[model samples]
Target: MKTILLHVSLVLCAVSSLQSRTWTEAQTGRKLEADFVKVQGDAVVVRAANGSTMQLPLARLSEADQTFVKEQAETATKPATTAAKTEEKSSGKEDAKKALIGTWDGYMADSDGSRHGDIRLVITEEKITASNPRGGQEMGAGTYKISGKRIDATGTEGQFRGKKYEGIFDLDSKTLKWCSANDNPNSSRPTQMQTNPQAGQFLMVLEKK
Candidate 1:
């Protein structure tokens, strides 16, 4: 627990800086100015000025960039760090799953902060049901999977049948924040909780009922 707390603290410190730096590609020498988010596997995640996050290959980065990532990764737990991180993620998934099994009241919002819809969601261990609370109309019913903070909801019935909604979730005891593909089933998963309806992304804010 101490190691985990230390690791989290170190990562928080690193990300808190949110400093933008020019990163150069090893071969192409192409440069991009972005803030370091975190290192994921063989790639480093960075946030562009526009708040979009992207991954760049560690090997493709200049030596200085590579060193920076390495230092961040090693600053926490050193021995078998990769395995430790994987275990941590798995544990988090289980905890999140438990926290999600409840009914929620919420509203979905468009990118421009317009009210898209009012939603009531019932989530169980095996399935999820979405409805329009004001109209008593069922909107969707689906089976959902949670992995770490990532969620995938595949519709098996109702209006959302045959569609898969991919999203990342932030959950606490009372509140849940979801950023997901909106309207377009084929759209990619959202990395942030902010809505961008033009980009086929929407944000849902819910409170446990």
Candidate 2:
């Protein structure tokens, strides 16, 4: 029993010794010692050595950190390298995810195109803060998650509290088009346009700043 207890203790120690590395964020040059959690559509989420969670954009990471991501991207390809199509697809997703970092600004509008609001949205590797003002009234500041073109958002405070929203990002044009959900059963969110609005929907068009 004594020998068995000693071996178990040794195993636990080895497991506990597995430590995460400290990573430097590129845009801010801030360092975070953490274990990588996963790569979401637009950011890398990590659990810090101190137990804090963070989300950072790839472009926001330091060059070394970006190199780390490139290495990871290469490493991720090893398993699927046997299939050409799968490799291309994985590479595409990785590229698209990286391009999503930056600040985007534009305007929001109601479905009828008559009423509009100013919009400013900033995206880092891990968090998105979006603000849309209606006639100088701040409706909310939202935090969002992106996967492919799909976006899911939650209002952190204000009247937007307890509300959820959905939207899309057009990666190529650096445009983000998203909206709050319509309350009525038959209605859908508005489509993004440069000039006019669609019916019964609210739309926003923000270009990267």
State the displacement of the C-alpha of residue 208, model 2, in Å, after optimal TM-score superposition.
Answer: 1.6
Q: Mind sharing the TM-score for model 2?
A: 0.44
Please state the error at residue 46 of candidate 1 in Å.
54
lDDT of 1: 0.80
TM-score of each: 0.56, 0.44
The TM-score that candidate 1 achieves is: 0.56
Q: Model 2: runs farther than 4 Å from truth?
A: 1-91, 112-115, 132-139, 179-200
lDDT of 1 by residue, 112-141 (tens): 667678999999989999998889888879
Root-mean-square deviation of every model: 18.4, 20.4
After TM-score superposition, the amount by which residue 94's alpha carbon in candidate 1 deviates from its true location, in angstroms, is 1.5
